[model samples]
Target: MRTRIITAIVALAIFVPFVIKGGIPLTILISLLGVIAVGELLFMKKRLLVSFEALVSFVAVVVTILPNSFWRLLPAPAFLNPRTLIYLFIFLLLLTTVLSNNKLSFDDAGALSLGVLYIGFGFHFFLQARAENWMAFVFGLIIVWLTDSFAYIIGRKLGKHKLIPKISPNKTWEGSIGGTAVATIVAIIFAESTHFATHFSLFEIVLATLVLSIAGQFGDLIESALKRYFGVKDSGTLLPGHGGILDRFDSMLIVMPIIVLIGLTA
Candidate 1:
């Protein structure tokens, strides 16, 4: 617990500044995070961090994470569209299977490909949210954090039925519902307190908040499912007592994408 608290404090110290200064610096920060998140999935899959998949997937993620403006600023030769680069890298991943005489296997390449999309788009949407609306960004983070926090607190006290004991044994329906309920309320309060104006109507914002809160829980469960399948405890060891980048940002990974998909960006 102590380690977890300290890690959160330190992480925020770095995170808040980049968030406030959203530009190339923030882009660089998120790109680095996307790289690490991809690395964690590679490690979980029993792939070497220095392997071909790692190199290819890292590049794929960075390509996906780079905003449209940044991509335009690159040198002429580096002007390949993001999709073009992604497709090229993906082909390379499959090529590795044949090159290695099937040692890497088709399934391995597929997994890495999926990881690229999962981590890549997740961070890309995060960057988009920050770039699009500051309030929208904060709202998404609050949904994930408050939902997790309240779920733990209320679940311990009032939990009865397990939400999904097989994947995350600690989660309960009581906690899940209670968490979403509280998060929704808090999000509305935040919206009101900050006079969080957006193109969307207040009704739309409230509805979106509810959706994001629910999505955040699903995101948590998705990561838990991944860990269960990998037979590992944490995603990585980067954060003390907090697991890894994925562990810390798993909920956000899901929320960020939904924030854009559902037009939560103010």
Candidate 2:
């Protein structure tokens, strides 16, 4: 517990400044995070499968940063939504091919692809969010962090009934509610402070906050399920006292894309 608190403080000390600055520094931080996430996925899988999976994940990350027109390089009759088509193509391509007869077989490849899309493809959402409005992009991050922190602290203190015993035993309904409430409050504060007052009503802030917070919790649950199914604890030991890159940012990965989409539409 002490280690976790200390690590959180140390990470914030390093991260807060760049977040406030929000430019190339933040972009570099995002790129480094992408690299670390790729490393974590490779680390989680079998050694033999690591290379290929990492390569594919890397390509996904690259595609995320690249322009949408670049995807037109692929053979035609593409869907108006190139992103969806691209993901579907990747999924089908992997499902059809036989990688190896090993334990981490075709099924594992599918799982890894899911991770890639979750982490890699989702990052494009972050990029899009930032491109639209840097403030909105940062707000999404703040909302996810607030939600996770509230959930952890509240669950640890007052939790009785398990939310998902098979995945994350510590989570509870009380914690989930507390997290959502706190996130909603923070979102409202952010909207007002950032001059979203003219553009969005209190109801809109509340709605966006609700969506992001729920999505963020679902993201955490998803990662927990993945770990439970795989019989592993912590995605990797890359970060001392924090498990790994994925362990720390699982919810953020999922929420960022959704928030980005909302920002784009809004």
Candidate 3:
């Protein structure tokens, strides 16, 4: 518990400044984080880390996380967009299987490809959220933290039934419900106090916060499921008590994309 709190402080000290700055620095930090996240997934697959497939996966992740404005840096042949480049990198991963004499395997390629997309888009939208609006982006962060904290507190005191004992034994349906309900109310209050005040109706605010609160819980569960499948206690041991970059940011990876989408439609 002491280690966890200390690590949180240290990480926030480093992370919050860049988050507040919100430019090249933030982009670089996020990109590095995305790469590390991909590395975590690759490490799970073992041998693939040393293979050519890893390179392709890393490049694809970097490209996927680049903002639309950054594409201007790509010289000439304007039709070769980010999506095209990403697909090309994925194609390289697929081709690596044949080139490696099938040692790499199609299954390996599929896994790397999926990891690139999931981690890539996850971080990409995270950057997108920061770029779009601080208040809006922070909405995702606030809800996730609130939900997780409340769920833990509520679950410990009153939880009985398992939410998904197979994946995350500690979580409970009661806690999940309590967390989301509390998070939604707090998030709505937050939105009311922020930019969401002018643009959203009370109904709209309720609907959006409710969806985001629920989505945040699912995000944590999804990461828990990944770790369960990999037979690992945590995604990695980079953060000591926190486990890994993925462990700390798992909810954000899932919530950021949803928040960005929510912004788009709203």
Candidate 4:
């Protein structure tokens, strides 16, 4: 518990400044995080499958998160476009499967592809969300943190019924409800106190927050499922009590994409 609190403080001290700056520095930070997350995922996979998966994930991160302007500046061929890169990677994976004498199964190929899309693509949207509006990004982070914290506290105090004992045994229905409620309240307070109130209608804000809060919980469950499948206790031990970059930012990965989509439509 003490290690967790100290790690949280040190992490915030480093992360908050980059989030506030919101430019190349933030991009670099997020890109590094994406790469580290991909590395962690590769480590979780079977040893024989790690090499190509790492390569694909690294390339995906580079293509997905780098600004379009950066791509434009490069004197690369048209085939180097992001979509083309993805297609080429898929083709290579299929070809490798055919040639490797059954060493790499379709399941391995699928896992690699899923890892690249899920982690790399998700972090791409995270960068886009922060670039769209730093305040909204901050608000989304607040919602996730508040929801998780309140849920844990409420669950410890009053939880009775299990939410999903298979995927996340510690979570309870009472905690889930308490977390969502706290997230909604925080959203309302944020909206009322900030300039966001002037831009978005009350209905829009409420709807968005409700979706984000639920999505955050689903994200947590998904990560828990991944850990169970991998037969690991935590994603990694890089952050002491925080597990890994993925563990620390799992909810953000899901929330940021939804937030970006909401911003686009609004």
lDDT tens digits by residue: candidate 4, 1-266: 99999999999899989988877898888888888887787777754324764676677766777756566888989878878887777667667678876576677777767777787667887877777776787778888999999999999999999999999999999999999999999877887787653667888788888889999999899899999999998888889988998898889889988887777223
Better of 1 and 4 by lDDT: 1
lDDT tens digits by residue: candidate 2, 1-266: 78878888898899778766755676667667776776666666654434655565666655554434345655756563447644864664374455443444566667666666677666656655665677777788888988988988898888887887878888999899888898889877887888643566777778878988999899889878877776789887866788987888788777877776565225
Ranking by lDDT: 1, 3, 4, 2
Q: Which tens-of-lDDT digit does each residue in 126-221 have in candidate 1?
A: 999999888878988899999999999999999999999999999999999999999999998898787655567789878888889889999899
Q: Comparing candidate 1 with candidate 2, which one achieves the higher TM-score? A: 1
TM-score of each: 0.95, 0.80, 0.95, 0.92
Error of 4 at 231 (Å): 1.1
What does the lDDT read for residue 142 in candidate 3? 84
Instruction: Kindly list the per-residue Cα lDDT of model 3 for residues 15-118, writing each as its tens digit.
Output: 99999999899999989898888889888777556557777787889989988778888686977888899889888988888988988889888988888888
Worst 10 residues of 3 by lDDT: 257-266
- Runs in model 4 with CA error above 4 Å? 48-50, 72-75, 197-199, 264-266
lDDT value, residue 108 of candidate 3: 80
RMSD to native, candidate 4: 2.0
Model 2, residue 254: displacement in angstroms?
1.7
